[model samples]
Target chain A: MTTSDTSVLAPLADVDPADLARLHAGLEAAADRAGQLDIAYTTFDSPVGPLLLAATETGLLRVAYEIEGHDRVLETISARISPRILRAPKRLEGAMRELDEYFAGRRTTFDVPLDLGLSAGFRQLVQRQLAHIAYGHTQSYGQVAAAVGNPKAVRAVGTACARNPLPVVLPCHRVLKADGSLGGYAGGPATKAILLELESAA
Target chain B: MKTGKPPFEGVVAEHSATVLRVCRAVLGVDEADDAWSETFLAAMRAYPDLPADANLQAWLVTIAHRKAIDVTRARQRRALPVENVPEVATTVPAPGDQDDELWHALKALPDKQRHAVAYHHLGGLAYNEVAEILGGTTDAARRAAADGMKALRTSLMGSKGATR
Candidate 1:
């Protein structure tokens, strides 16, 4: 299906816990049927908060808020993807290493490969702009738009930042309003502020 | 002609972490980073030809998996096995040590089972979807995930004696 269709099919947030459990169980069963499906999972600290990382045969697959129910996040992801899920700590080594170095102020840029296949144009443009934001600096949405060669697309850029999938990796938190206001983020403005503050401190 | 390039950058932003996870799982961490980049670069090249109905996450994962496997094979052929593949360090949290144990148990499953479990339990994919990306049928995917869960339950129940 189109990426949009898949995005639309992503498990809705309001699914009942009981239903989520059932889905989770079904997933477990599916994994068994497929034989050994290797996955590596780990928990790491980020500027925002504790994060749970899940990796598979591809790359980093799930980065969930630690405070959020892992099952709920799984349900949301599964509703859009597949039934084979595993918890793998070993798989997260690359991300964890990069993240640790980042937090320690030893690394300024991330070399991890990113897959942004699910998003569309405006959002992609906005995320790209966010990436160019210097580690210790911030830019307004208007500036981001201008950077993307669409100075008139400030509102669109804001929407793009709002929908950014990679969040910290793409540095969407660096996008602010022309008035120097912190723009909205899917991860919350508070988290964005903390990220900005953390980068600034570094 | 393709009217416009698909919003690949947007897709990367949304799904990069997920794709990275898949690469790591398949190729381990050292090779995963490279494989992950290759997957995206390939995706960019193929974007114009991709079907609209394809699930972007699954599609990317599939590509990443292939890329990881390719890298591993190439490395093996070159006799350049990466030494000292990093292990996931266990940092005990003040609370919730049990969950950590459970996570460790989940990690012990074989690769295919792990992928199935991660996709279903963590990535939250349906059996059919998992099968599609993993190159198997729904039934096969279900069976792999079930086997993995069975192993996990057994390991967790016997944690007292199981190797940590």
Candidate 2:
């Protein structure tokens, strides 16, 4: 569209600033009173089977699979945060772009920033080790534990992978069991299997 | 009003189109989705403390606008080496015969003016409303929108004049 058409829309302008100010103030008041916000929703047809993504200003806090009772999950998030939640596919910009590139075989590594605040120290260490796992390569949990400077932390590394905050970005899927088993993924073993397969195919 | 309900659900349901329009105006269709999502997420986090009497639509618009700007800035930051970054092909479909070319022209405008026009015109917001959302005064909003509209008109007319 050209600028001329936009000029014609000038006649439609008439919103009140006071109304905007009032709205902003009201929302702030509600959030403050509520403590945290409950913002959880899912979009479909994602390469990874109806992906679930959630976040706050502090950073991404959760990503899950599409199970039943999604509303209950949303309520849980709201209870932890506030009830001022909304759902829109657009908010997953960085994640979506990286996922798209990964699926398209154009990207082997994700450069997106992550907020692993919710993760514990050991989990963070495991995540860091997982990040170093080369594309199209898999490492046993023992190997990851060794990489994290805790040779006996293999079991801890497995648990840490289960608790990883940023999954796809950190490549926790790359960590297999000591016997080369697929191990576990919070998103599901099948999802992990598919991701590894995709990397191998690429 | 009773508390405990989702604070901005009403406002979101009411003004979602406006928020989406602002996002579309700023980031174009491809990236508007993410900007819109971030805006709502930010709103959700900020909603409880929002003043009771504020204009919800404008508040959402302001947030959406900021999110759009952030998305663009982030994209610019992540721009790869020239060889790695593929050329952006123009995929915007052609306008229909009855379609107004003014919005198309407006999209060609600089980011600030484009935002000004979207907030004031497409959003059906007053100059003061635009200003508040943009962190400026009524006069500034008016000036930006006016300048944007003027540019759009001139450009459109020039194109038409050439065609004639």
Candidate 3:
């Protein structure tokens, strides 16, 4: 809707672009001061594609692939977590750096803390086990299921990896299909292959 | 409660401009940004508790109304000394700024009329909702907005004709 309700006020309806920017920055700072910003996120270009990284005070919350739709991912975060989210890159600085290093083949492991609040129960259990798969190591879904102490829950393990909130950081891409073929990835098969290839080369 | 609230960031992105317009209309530019920031900060704080299906714009305008009053109260508390008062007691926005003539005309309207116009017309609230926010009957809010618009046109036309 137009800012002006009447023709007379329409002329004055234009909010100065500079003022809007300045005011938003001020709001972000104020929200942070008030402890109202629940999530801070940033997007960085990666070898596979752009990745959306989000964090809470606890630690890194999510890592979304470009194919997953950044806006949709943020909306899901808002729904599941708190909606007081902002695109504050500073909160994700460490995670972003580690990701860059990993993609560049200079790093093998992530040291950043993970929130792991998005997944729960068996899914959370499976996600937690994924990190131990190591940087360049691969595990079949059946293998991962058994590792989590549920040999018959192979399909469930696949679901957990597919729904992984922190994919690359948690190393869900390392979980492959039973036949050693690429399994379904939250970041899509092509991205899964890219991550796997990047790791295998290193 | 509908149980699904979108991100507060979306709320800010969608409605910040309108809220700023309402604030600028109510408090002028110098204080509008402050009011806008305060309103969103407050909104973000209270967002989780808000009903998922509530009318967001009207809710935000209501908050902006409160914040604007706070600003006005602060301004009054910081009143200048008699000798320090300017010859023209108007808040004239910078020259060559967007909508200078219109802002001057808007600045001339009475407080109730200005708020009625801003909340209903600029903020896109219904007259009844504006009435609820303004604490008056719906008809009164409608009349106030109509009068405010008329005054704006008269003042703007007079100034425009004089300049031409």
Candidate 4:
């Protein structure tokens, strides 16, 4: 609907931008305090691109690349998890720090707690084994499938790695194709290459 | 569970400015911030149960309306006469201090007119939605907002014209 068409009322029509920002920050904090914030998220500028870090009170939930569409990912999280989400950067501080260290090459393993609610059954089992692949090491889809106790599920393993909700944190980039080619990645192929190079160089 | 609702953060990010302007118009700036925060906090709490197709801006304005009423009631209870009054000074406003004459004029409006203007004009809701919130017919809500704007123009512009 259009606002009232009166120039004398122009000043009343809009809120100061800075004041609106301050109000948003306050509301975010208030929501967090009241334990109503079901999911908290923030964006970080990473070497791969901007990463969307989101979490629930349970643990770190989803980390998305800009290519994945941050808005779409958030909608998915809202649908799959809960719609009570807020952009509160402070809640993701722990995961952010661990990722910061991982990208800096100073840390190999993620110590932050994770919420694997986005995946289930076979996919969850596949992601659980990804962290054991070692930092600079590579594992074939067949190998991961075998390791997860489904030796015949090689293609399934490939699908799991491709659909991994938490990519960098779960080390899906370490899983490669049987032909030694980077099969596919959620963050695109070039990003997978950058992550692989970052690990191998360290 | 529904599988297509957009994140509540999107709701907050998109409509917060409008909500703030609505609150400020209805309750004045000092009370507006608290009303805005309380409204969002309440909205977030009940968000999961909200229908996916719900009008988010109108929904938020509904919540803001309730919150503004609560704030107004609390302010009324806290209203007390001061023992000593400072001398009235006609000091010019400081650099960062907002010019509050317009806000004062808005607060002086009758409650129905103030609410109608805030909900329809600033909150961007249709007259029917404003009527729903204010408990009246759409035409009445429209008339109240129009009347409120007319009064504000007469007072604020008339004062400005007198000075010039």
Candidate 5:
């Protein structure tokens, strides 16, 4: 019950919060507002097509192929992860730059941190193993399955590759059919062929 | 009462306007974004530590008050290219003349009173909380805010008539 030092203050004038909201949205969309939105995403155009990169505070979340559709991809991830999503390009700068280098044939492996919350269980296990398949390298789906301690789960490995949340970043394109033929790819076989050719040419 | 922790985005949605009003009052509209950004950045970094029952608005405004001081100090050390900057380079639209007059008046008040008024009225903190931020007994903060209000009433009217 001590005496306080301030005088009675007048009510401040009403300000339009809409301006602040819009400003927040604008910042969250671009350079200023970083690490605030729960899920921040950006789109990058590569030789394959428009690639959608989404991230969480943990790290890079998803790298969606064009065939999956960026809007649909983002909507699905936002629902699964957190709904407070925004197009924060600043947060995706590292991924974009790395993708650029990869596409330019100057880089062999991805070095950015990844948020692998999209996949789990045996699929997650397979994805981690897939990441180690270096540039210009291809392993048969059965080979990848054996690497994950389930040599008989050849079809499971194929399923995992098809459902990869991060295709290009995790290098899931390196997995193919047992007969050395191009298997199914989430980004379409044509895109897979492009990636395989790029790696081989590199 | 739900004991669940609402997301940090919810905090931003709930309190951004109050924080903006506090910053605009203390730093004026031109530099308010600087304070706003710094405040939220700091808050987000420390959000995990915030108590579930904490007064979210007051906590944010306190961070904002500290950030405003930092901006002022940084501005002091930097060279003043402010006056010579071209209009086209500025992104934020200037406030309308009427709003501009109020800003001019608020900026004219003494720093402590302006801060006191902002923290108490705009930021919606109690006098005791304002005192903690302003570094005084609650009574002193009350006096400063009252004095600031008296000055604003005089200037808001005087400046309005004179600007015509």
Candidate 6:
């Protein structure tokens, strides 16, 4: 971005491809060294903006929509998980393929290993319950609360769904309001609508 | 203490290009790639323990300097010329090609001077940092770099005049 850089590098600008290839080779080596890595992640563009996907040794941990600020999410992951994270797309290849299939209406359920590290206890319980809501099916927040053995925790169920770390995988978008209307979504209202329409049409 | 930072991927994305540039400047086009690969691999291995307040670029350049030294020593030990990988062929190794001339001039300097110019001007390290890299006093580093630049300019101008 600086003129100083261009002046200094004037001779080398033409020699790009060879250096880039070497960089990739080195990065591949780094990627292969997974022992020091606590998390590996990548971004996949979806029908609804870019989805920032992160994973741990255990499994896929975080699925953040563009609305959640991908940079901020990565910082949180570094703070909460081990800071030894890298952008290794090979780790997220399966999740991306599955997401592609789901968006194309060729698949309903995600099969990638879920980390569930971000959500736990009652919230995690609610996430698991949400996953059972079946593709193209809708469940009221009250119904989800009752299923999780906290019938009086209608608001809690809504909170759990909104904070669902892995949205598309957990099918949290399938959770509707008690009056059968599309409820709030962490990924934004328009994205929730698009997901609902995608599912219903399938 | 909350020492929050972007993912390691962000770090790589942010600085890999600059590191490559520095490597190429220090090592020249033919051997720069190998030095660059080693430099980044080493950086990534040690990235987790790097202090939050560390100057990431400077740290990377330091690693690059060490890697360059290792690579140069290895090349000297080798008896055979390197097999040229297929490069994007540019016709006419033309004169006034400032880029090519710069590398030629850089490689022509004395070892200490070459390193001084590279670690200071190209790698953007301070005199003290360059001194640390070169294992010399700060004054020595500054003098070597200045002398190196004079030699580089003379060689470059000579090349330009010959072609004209």
Q: Could you report the DockQ of all the candidates, in the order they appear? A: 0.02, 0.13, 0.58, 0.68, 0.14, 0.46
A175-195: candidate 3 lDDT, tens digit per residue: 888788987888888888998
Candidate 4 off by > 4 Å? A1-5, B80-98, B160-164
Local accuracy of candidate 5 as per-residue lDDT tens digits, B111-155 = 999999899877878899999999989999989988887787777
lDDT of each: 0.62, 0.68, 0.86, 0.86, 0.80, 0.80
Which of candidates 1 and 4 reaches a greater TM-score?
4
lDDT, candidate 3, B1-164, per-residue tens: 12557877788878989999999999877788889988998998999999877999999999999999999998877775444677245655677665665667777799999999899888989999999999889999989998898788777775567321
lDDT for B135 (candidate 6): 86
By DockQ rank, best first, the candidates go 4, 3, 6, 5, 2, 1
True contacts kept of each: 0.00, 0.28, 0.75, 0.86, 0.12, 0.61
**Better structure of 3 and 6 per DockQ:** 3
Candidate 5 chain B, poorest ten consecutive residues by summed lDDT: B1-10
| Error in Å for residue B30 of model 3 | 1.2
Off by over 4 Å in 3: A1-5, B80-84, B87-98, B159-164
The DockQ for candidate 4, computed on C-alphas, is 0.68
Give residue B163's error in model 1 in angstroms: 41
DockQ-wise, the better of 4 and 5 is: 4
Docking class of 4: medium
Worst 10 residues of 1 chain A by lDDT: A1-10
lDDT of 2: 0.68
Q: Which numbered prediction scores highest in lDDT against the true structure?
A: 4
Candidate 1 Cα errors over 4 Å, as ranges: A1-41, A55-58, A66-70, B1-164
Q: What number of clashing residue pairs does each candidate have, in the order they appear?
A: 86, 53, 0, 0, 17, 1
In model 6, where do residues sit more than 4 Å from their true spots? A1-9, A13-18, B80-101, B159-164
Q: Rank the candidates by TM-score, best first.
A: 4, 3, 6, 5, 2, 1
**Per-residue lDDT tens digits of candidate 1, residues B26-83?**
4544465677667766665565467767777777776766776689788767755655
